[model samples]
Target chain A: MNQRLKLFWAGVRAEFPLLIGVFPFGLIYGALALSSGLSATAAQMMSSIVFAGSSQFVTAQLVHGAAPGLVIVLTIAVVNLRHMLYSASVAPYVRNLSMRWKALLSYFLTDEAYAATIIHYEEEELTPASHWFFLGAGLSLWFTWQVSTAFGIFLGTSIPESWPLDFALPLTFIAMVVPVLKDRPVIAAALSAGLVALLAFSLPYKLGLILAALTGIIVGMLLEGKESPKEAL
Target chain B: MNIWLVMLLGGLITFGMRLSFIYLLGRFEVPETMRRALRFVPPAVLSAIVFPEVLMPSGKFDFGLDNHRFLAGIVAVLAAWWTKNTLLTILAGMAALLILQLVL
Candidate 1:
């Protein structure tokens, strides 16, 4: 096989495990989006347009609640702000690439793609082939997401309304956030955010979520700063 | 106010964020504090959302045994912590919630 194919397959192999985790999420998103009253086209388009999983889930929730368009748009912006970090992390590695290459890769920079691609770039330290690795990982995820979402939309129409699958959204989040609680700052962040969210739940347009998230972020940053002054600099 | 417009703008904002640092890499530097803060963004934001959903299912708080979401959320947290498996945690929580709702 050619070098490009080799790099692509290597990327695929590294991302396979993550893809397993992501498949269920895509399916759930599709099903929940439908249950939340989105048309099939809207549900499918969301997978491509927004492309981020958690934000897409939150968007479906806000849309279902009949939130103003601006509010939902703002929420999506805040939720996806972390991507800027990923962009920075990978920027130096791909600096030499053309603007078109940068644009294409940016479009594919979801969590799974970033995880696999960054690890590949760090490990291989390859000057250009890392781009191929990113392409492979990203295209694989993009393909899987589209197909799984379509399947979910089709399956969602058949499932009974009594199933209560919407609860899966929060459950999915619990699963995600719980494992990441590895240390004091992270735990503090989670606990503080949870408490504030409870207190602020009555806020309109889900502004409470934004406030709660900011509070947690600040608390975590402060705690972390004390431990690592270099990080504070 | 239209749903489509919301999605379109959301998509645009999302794309912009993803493009932000990459577009400005040579021209700017991300502050160290901002980078550290970004580290906490995921855990903080996710928990902020999760807590309200599990603890306050309706308009009010419910922390007692009758709160199936809270109980199931605890189960999911334990599963995630022990297994480090997202799928397993979700499945366990969903199953637990289903059972709790049926029983109570």
Candidate 2:
């Protein structure tokens, strides 16, 4: 076998552990997206279109709640803002690739892909086959995400609508966000956003969510920036 | 406000973010403040959604024990905080919700 293919398969094998985690989320995302009032086509298309796991889930929840298009798009951007860092980190190694390769690789750069690629890059950073390794890691994840989403959608269609499955959406979000709320600013941010969301619930076109999210971000940022001596203690 | 349009725009923006630094490549450095702000986006955004759903289930404040989702959400929070397990936290929250809704 060729060295690039050998490296690519090694990258794919490395992704197996991470795949165990993402596969279920993809399934639940498909199930939730459907219950959130999206058509089957839209639900499946989203697996490819947005391609970011958390942001796709958030988009489904917002769409289910009848949020306007603009707000949903804005939320997607915010949730995915972290990807910029990944792009920067991976750029130098793949800098010699063509524009087409850059664009394709950028689209494939999910959390799992970046995780696998970065570790490989640290060791084999400038190897000619490094991009192939990235492609292997990314393509494996993309395949799994799509297949799992389709399976979830199939299962979603059979479940009765009266079962209150939609509750899973927020429940899933709680599970994800709660684990990350250890820091003081993050805790404050969560509290502030939750409160603001309630207060601004009646705002037109669901603009309140955007308002609440912004307020939380700004508050968290300000608190972090103005760390007092007492906080240091 | 079409769903397809929203997705198209969202996808493009996501692609842009993922491509931004890579394309710019040593030309512009991300500011320290911006980096710090990015860390808060997930908790802030997710909380904004989770809070309204649980606390305002009917689009009005409901703080009583009868509010199953609110109670269940708290359970999930504890499960997540303690275990840091995604599947376990979800199962705990769902179980709590099911039991609460039936009892209340």
Give the per-residue lDDT digits (tens) of candidate 2, residues A1-233: 49889888988998888787777778888888988889989999999999998889889878877887888898888778778878877888888888898999999998779989999999864777778889899999999999989988989878776666667778778877887787888889888988999999899866777788889988888787677524321
True contact recovery of candidate 2: 0.74
Candidate 1 contains a number of clashing pairs equal to 0
Question: What number of backbone clashes does candidate 2 have, counting pairs of residues 3 or more apart or in separate chains?
Answer: 0
For residue B75, model 1's alpha carbon misses the true position, in angstroms, by: 0.6
> Candidate 1, DockQ to 2 decimals?
0.75
Give a tens-digit lDDT track for model 1, residues A100-147: 989888999998899899988888867566688888899999999998
* Candidate 2: segments with Cα more than 4 A from true spot: A119-126, A228-233
Off by over 4 Å in 1: A231-233
